[model samples]
Target chain A: MYKGARVETIVSISWETLLDGVKKGNVRSLARIITLVENREPGWKDAMKSLYPLGGKAKIVGITGSPGAGKSTLTNAVARDFVARGYTVGIIAVDPSSPFSGGALLGDRLRMRDVVTLPEIFIRSMATRGALGGLCQGARDIARILDAFGKDVVIIETVGVGQDEVEVVKAADLVMVVCVPGQGDGIQALKAGIMEIADLYVVNKADREGADEVVADIGGMLDISDNGGRPQPPVIKTSALANQGITELVDALVQGFESGRNADSWQAQRVKEEILTLVETEILDYLRENWERTGDLDKAVEGILEKQTDPYSVVDSLLPLIREASRSKETT
Target chain B: MNNKKIRVLIAKPGLDGHERGARIIAYGLRDAGFEVIYTGLRQSPEQIVSAALQEDVDVIGLSILSGAHLSLTKKVVDQLKSNDAEDILLVVGGVVPEQDVASLKEMGVAGVFTAGTSVSQVAQFISEQVNA
Candidate 1:
């Protein structure tokens, strides 16, 4: 009978039902709630509003790099180190969602096989889900939930520092940029989008050929760009494949976060971005809810698709309609 | 033998980003008459759930080589139940130890496919679960 209930009724269950599972540290329920929120289902806003006050307790760290830069291995090793030190860790791996079907082939979690079994650790793999950089919001929200759930550290490892990924890592307290030897375009790519944001740069696959040269190149780039605003970000060499330099990387992460250098400004920025994101999400939700009822936006969409109306014109017309609707409702 | 597409979501939880196995599985699943939604590496529990929900998937296959499977999987299960999405089948394949299989199953994971398990076995299991 419970399984046969309507979705709206099922979702309408008391928050206690959901919170009970979350409080019990039920991972399945947590994952399910995250999915609901990530998918932006009806009534998720109310659920999150309920869960909001319980957040702001976890320290979030972001890791980004070029593809094959050993970002995953570094994340795994770092998480293992944290767990060994008796700290609970939550990890969000940001993957690219399939645009065609809006599903994902997420496999990054396979890298941290050893530490994932620990009771104190939680890991989730996320995809873009048809929204560019939406995974960032998803990661941030889940991290908040994990923080509220009592996690000590939350690591958000993105799928390379593309424009969207850079925005995601900007939500972190500290960001680590990972690079590897022999990746010709990596340094260039990092400089283009990721180099500016890394609090720590890790040279993974350190045993590979030309590791020294790659390190030197990064050093030269940093030297020229060292603005002396804060301490020049540290460049640490690591070999995640061999498990070398993992402790040092962890130590660097602790020092970076605890020393309070990257914490303050980032937190302020994160809060600001979070507020904007919430507003945006709310507006989108409102639009979606009223889309069918109004038929105005649908007509606009159709016009845009058919090139009958420009986007600005559509917006110009829709804004007045929305304003009038709100005004009329208020008067009534 | 209707060739209806089997929609599958391959997700990674936590920071473990070794995606070769997931990519291989996606390709293999796609080749085997399934529409594999290969989310390219690193995902959160919420993102995976959203994917499963919006995609209206038949199976949610998680590939977690990370040792944090218990908590991660638990988080996912919790999300599903709360969203009233308990009907969607959950399966996991990765570097899981034999000892944890029972616990994962107890946590509502329908199938625990580990290393050395055949892709065909996973595909077949999914077929059985969804078609049952």
Candidate 2:
């Protein structure tokens, strides 16, 4: 019995089969392939190359906010509404990974129980995986996979911490910055970083006291910031627990996407960023691999420890090797 | 690579309201350098299996204290087989008797940790099984 199973394992699942399964909307296949690409498993690049063209159909929306802003609840409400509108939704909730253990406690999906049982909704919880920008590089790839898997909308939720979180949300077509009452000082501090990334400002937990004040604070900030004469992003109040203002939020999101549909320049800029990121990651990986293969990295570290060569001089010495590695990779 | 951490999904099946064991195991596994995805309470076999697939977890540790271990484990194992994911290591914990451990093993559970099993012991079992 185990012999046949061992043989099957030896012959890994083919890319064609996985791609066909994704096209047919098989959730298992979609899930499996997403894991493959997210881990950058062997042949992952080929898989992504095949699915890249099939994406861009789904409307990508990003929800980001402070740790206690009820981002997950708001995301759940928005996704539920999207499903009710006869659209399939995919959600990516990102949590921080532990630097010490290289592990993550992905509890965001627990808060999203409301939409988990819905057949039209697929929720995936991801760790930042040591990526600096609040999201792993695989996030964009996973979003594309979800888009290709036939979801009409994909929501990327990140814990808004710093510039990294803002950079993560910039990948979305519509970005919502969530604020809750009693976090006035926190929200005010974030206005310089996260506030600028919002295409819409959502005052979540509107049932709490000072909800109106928070909304007003956001409005006041918008008045002060010069938005280059463009219409200010609308600030909407929502109680995710009570499910208030979700419809209005959805409508605003749809209108936002509609109005920005013809903005090819913005889309081109996003693509440009994505391409640069991809190149940077690939080149770095190649350089590391080459250095490791040649024992140069260890030698360089030893030299630094011995104070034989300064850090800048070490890098200068490594530059020629890195260039040679890049050339070799290009030829291959 | 050697640095890659193992991912585990600790799921509670069959409407078990008790979550202390699962929570402890989740934290323990995380501290042991495993990315643990905890599915909270009251998960169906389908939900558990779907999560394991989507997360690409190397191990699935089901915490069932509702006396439905045999049936739930069978359903989960069957679902995993149907999804071509039988290679995933499966474990069971919570209120299990020695007599039923063999039965669970027969149903494809790799290990069983009853009450009083240390978190490190459970983590060690999982790490050994997955790496093996």
Candidate 3:
């Protein structure tokens, strides 16, 4: 129905239909809707608009740890526990995009063959898309979509590479930092990023030789970080392969979610971010629609790229042109 | 074989950070002619789902060596289903036990590759599934 109108009208119709399907707990529809949104097609905003009101019912749990700490196996165990308890779960697994190929190689489901077929469970894989923080905003958006779709628990898994992992810590109601024994720095490396955000610390692969030492290291680090005001994060040992300590880990998750004040803080932060995202969408839409019409944005980009003007000056020049166009449109 | 690269998203869900396997898989898949998106460690289920959707990937592979695999994969599958991405061939590889394999498959997982499994087997399986 839309003819070269910048955005597709089918996307909007399908989006609304998909939202309706999701609200009804239709699995196929849920998957399709997510695909539309994740692709960020022109009409994704419309689908999100329809689905946004349906989200936020889900409890978001974040699990992070250092590389080689068995976080995925731990997450798999926890997810099984949640399902056993009769909760519909959603998972958001984050990975870094391949710089060379611009595509992703997401294998979070590799170990989860048995669980992935559960009719009640939903899973989605996301990429950083070169976002500054490791936790991609696109991931957050899809989480909202899943939440809207009536998932009882939403688990967000991040690749703990650099600041992005820390950013994920900001979004979770309970942040579990998974660690293993025998890393060169032990829990010391975690002390900087993983330790600070943990509601619970998991010493995974506890069957390994240095499991005890890893736990002790974490204990020592926790002792040093006893800031008095913050409740000390608990450390539990588990061999995800052996299915050891998963129940306890789930218990800790429940306890942490039930007790954390920071969850409320995160809720507020998410709300603020949602507002900013909507604003960003509108601004970009406006720029795309009007900038070309006025022929000013191209000039600004050219000026900035050509070194004839700095970014700040380009923005300064572009703002007045936009303002004048808006004023003219308002009068017209 | 047309030699078309299969784009894959290898992600870590929740807070599980054992990424050596994930990294190796990423590298291996890339070498096998699959465009691998390896989000270099510690990712949320939401982030993972979003990435797969954006990239229009044929498969979404999760590497969760953590015991939380049940919860993480369930969440990813649930989210993918919720977004109409149930067809995206969800596969998991890492620290998985034999007993839980059935349950994971029951949850819509197409494949489960545990430790000692050859990366080529994975790449080949993915190739067949995506092609099919």
Candidate 4:
């Protein structure tokens, strides 16, 4: 009877039930809980608090590259390999949200058709959701949810626009930056910022002409850059479409994880960064709500439009009011 | 804190090879300030319901051009009910016939849009249903 009631309450599932389902490896329950946390539904924070300790068992991998670099196909190939190796893989494919409508055309699954049906694999597409750094606000939390749900490996694929792509480094234990042939100066372009974040560099579509040139370019760039006493990231060549080089890439990823296992300092740093990000998002949200409720935000905008006060000055004046609001909320 | 943007899933269920209607509706919903997630062609009822639940969408607009709306929509509706997700606003759009509109509504689909229906009409209907 209790089991029937539990089955009947799927739509309005409680957090306790969802948590139990997650622990038991129920895909539907895991998907539902991901929605709850992603949407920040009521009691979401409590859910996170309960699930956090259950995480830390899964290996998180971040894959990123420029648009049109075949990131999705590469992810699909890698996922298939992981599944073959007896690992439960969770994939988070991030796509850009339309700036105008704030909606997203998440076509990542189209390229992932091959691995979508695998019983051990779960693939989810995410929109940037106005989060500037190639990832959504709840992506890390979602990854944690997958971790706690018993996935052995969780892979996050970024939207792959430069600079913003670096954000994935903070969330993954190993970050793979993928590049392709025929872009000519593309390898050189990546040298500035993105090259540094790579735990492994993959030259995808290696069967195409100019693949070796891109590989050499990356190798040349890696040699020139100062690693500050750390070993340079390995560069692997792969044609994801042809199902080549994926095993080598996955092996390197596993090796990277093994080497970094005892790196307590990096783990601590990641936790600190996570905490700061959460606090920053929450405080900004609180400040925005307070300003809007007090009508100060609208007033400031009006003043700026009327040319009565400059934007910086408006912010300066509103700071005290925001501070006061924070104080009052704390006391209450 | 309740300024949550509406999320809608525009899914193509069954083996409908033609996706022009679904694509158009996805674009329309996005332009209307809703976060729309488009699940491409050849989705099963189970896949559609799973996507909706995972996405936590407020509204699900099913686009079916293949004349199997009754069975497909019924399967999706039944899955939603079993999952306790019947509260989600279920709307269908495509080459739906005038005669079948009442039956779709009877099967728990909130609204049905047929040929010649403008994108704004569908968007407005969804907004009203969600807000209501």
Candidate 5:
């Protein structure tokens, strides 16, 4: 059932039902549960706690690239290839929301028209919702929902990006940074931040004029930056427009994913990060809900706007509540 | 928190190649603070329903300009009904003739916007219909 944006009544969907639906691979239930999680509805953490144990099965892949780097098309091609190989796939395609309006035109599906109807494939469009990193925790949660739903693979396609958007690395088991021909000296891929995040590089639009040059540049740059004998990230060429080189890319993905993200220490590190992030989110959400309920949040914002205090002061003012909450938690 | 953003799917059904109107609505809805998922041109009713199901959108806005609003809208309405999605608000925009508007409403379309409807009016209508 469609709930209005401002619906005051309680969201009728219980987490239990959503969990059951997801377990059954019900597409509508999957979508609805994703909405519930993405909205961070109350009791969502408990819901996720139950759903979390059902996941850890799907191989999550993050696809990121510049605006025109064929991220969507490549995602489509790649996801279709996975389906053809008898894998159920889920896609979370993220786009930027308007900073001014908090709304977004999620058009990545436009490029993904071909796979929209495949029963084995499910695509959900997500807006970054002003998350500065071009991806959001909501997206991460949605990925987990897809995972619990028994999708063999889940693709997280971020909005067209530039240098320094490395959040995908934290979310995906393997991150494929896509670059296309004519986007300058391919050294941009090897630039300090983005280069470090890539498990592989895709030189999309290889049919374009500067394809070979871009490939050569990336290969040369990778040669220069070979540090500590770490395996050099592979640079695969794909023309997603003509559906060429996809098999090779998918083959590479199969090989890369086979290594598994379960190296004991690394897995421990991931769990640590996950717990810390969850703690941070829970604390903030608690504080926000409490303050908003008490109207202190509005007062603080008004204070800031009126020059009565600054954000630092507001943070300081909020610290006492956190301390109180911590004390209560320890007592409990 | 009850903080939530309304999600709308703006789709074009049939062979209508005129995208300017749909594009405007997509952008306009965004500026009005709604997450708009645009499934581009020539979407079948089945595809639209599928997209809505996958998106779990609160509203599905169809911009049909091909003079086949009645039949196309009927197919979409039927698809949604059969899929048990009657709660998803369905609105149509385009060159929908005034006379066909009553039949569309009878078929369960929530609202119809002809040539003169402003984006704010559409946005307001959605907010009203969706939240109520």
Candidate 6:
């Protein structure tokens, strides 16, 4: 915060203080370190690498659905339920940011009023930050930080998503797809991508007229979809606002907490996806860092702008740098 | 890209239902390319402090129209201090009496934007304080 100090140097020095604070159960420090990682400050990966071993204990949950599906309310109910049963909870509630402004009015806390003051629950409001998908990798990293902080469960309420945003699958150990009545007919349940990602389905707002029908429709879809070797996904009915049937939902989540350890059918695929994502990020970072410093990127841009060379040729020439770097990596 | 964008928590810390001012500031801050966390109506100061800590926001902007600015601001300031987060710059925006502004600043609020202050001015002041 000093006027002349470099942010990164401050971060590097404070990272220890942050880590020590987290270890000592300082909530403010835990929160600050989360910001450090979420913003991906320099040395962030090192911080994660240091804390990674302390993770793998807490269960991560992801809740996603169309806008107004009561994701936040249900998250509040579930987190409170978990805490009542003697488990600490962390929640990451995602809301969409304005793509134009790169800013967001994160209003999830408005719906999560009950848990805001709970000592057992740590709620964080996050914006999608132009991730295309409604979820961000940073959300998962924050989940890990919470796990390392010893929370028994971490729930990620994805920005009310559409039918195709499946990024939550990459992050949560258990994915709960929430559905409300009167949104659409059963056909809405059959959409290809999001339908396939549900570990459990909640017919939220069950007090409404069409609740059981929605549950039945999802149940019918589950019956038709080939199970292969996977267990049939369960559909539970709950009214998050009425507080009815919440215990059943919590029961399902707690059962998930146990079965998740056995590597549910999606675990292997999720790991592969995560590693691929990390590889893509790392490779892009390497090229951008190297090219910007070496001026090759600028040279390519200049050639393209001057119409002396095309992007195809530019990429063809630049691809070799990656090969050389990989070869060097292998040799070392 | 590694540079930290100032994250501001715009919270309403009393029972006042007038949320238009907070919404305006939230939109303004967002348009300024800052990550703004908008916790809606009637936030208790404890809740405000908790949200600030867990979100690790760079600054906290409380919007008050309940004529309880002094007491509300003091509670927020005291809670933040007790939580060891006094370093997070605090600001107040709303119908503050001109006479109460000095004491609000004395309570560690970095800036106070009374009615009619431009959003850009508030944003400019925040960036100067946080990104300096």
Every model's TM-score: 0.72, 0.93, 0.66, 0.88, 0.92, 0.92
TM-score of chain B of each: 0.94, 0.97, 0.95, 0.97, 0.98, 0.98
Any runs in candidate 5 off by more than 4 Å, and if so which? Answer: A1-10, A131-134, A162-164, A189-192, A226-228, A260-264, A290-318, A328-332
lDDT of 2 by residue, A153-208 (tens): 99999866766687787678888899899975536535547766678999999999
Query: Can you tell me the DockQ of model 2?
Result: 0.47
- Cα RMSD for predicted model 1: 8.8
Give the TM-score ranking, best first: 2, 5, 6, 4, 1, 3
lDDT of 6 by residue, A103-171 (tens): 777888888888999998898887777642324567878898999998999999887655324776458
lDDT of 6: 0.83
The 10-residue segment of model 5 chain A with minimum total lDDT is A1-10
The lDDT for every candidate, in the order shown, is: 0.74, 0.83, 0.73, 0.81, 0.84, 0.83
TM-score, candidate number 2: 0.93
User: Residue B68 CA error for candidate 4 (Å)?
Assistant: 3.3
Please give the lDDT score at residue B64 for candidate 1: 91
lDDT of 6 at A216: 83
Candidate 5: tens digits of C-alpha lDDT, residues A1-332: 33342253236656777788788878888888788777767777788889989998988888877778889999999999999899999999988888899999999889998799999999999887764332546677888889998999999998756442466556788889898877667556446477766778899999989988988987887787754555787889999989999999999888878874445355687667666776676667678778978898899999999999999999998889898766766775
At residue A118, candidate 2 shows an lDDT of: 85
For model 1 chain A, where is the 10-residue window of minimal lDDT? A1-10
True contacts kept of each: 0.07, 0.39, 0.13, 0.28, 0.76, 0.61
The predicted structure with the larger DockQ, 1 or 6, is 6
lDDT of 4 by residue, A17-72 (tens): 98998899877678778777776677888999999999989999988888888999
RMSD of every candidate to native, in Å, equals: 8.8, 2.5, 11.0, 3.9, 2.8, 2.8
Higher-ranked by TM-score: 2 or 4: 2
Candidate 5 positional error at B11, Å:
0.6
Which pairs clash in the backbone of model 4?
Answer: A11-B83, A11-B84
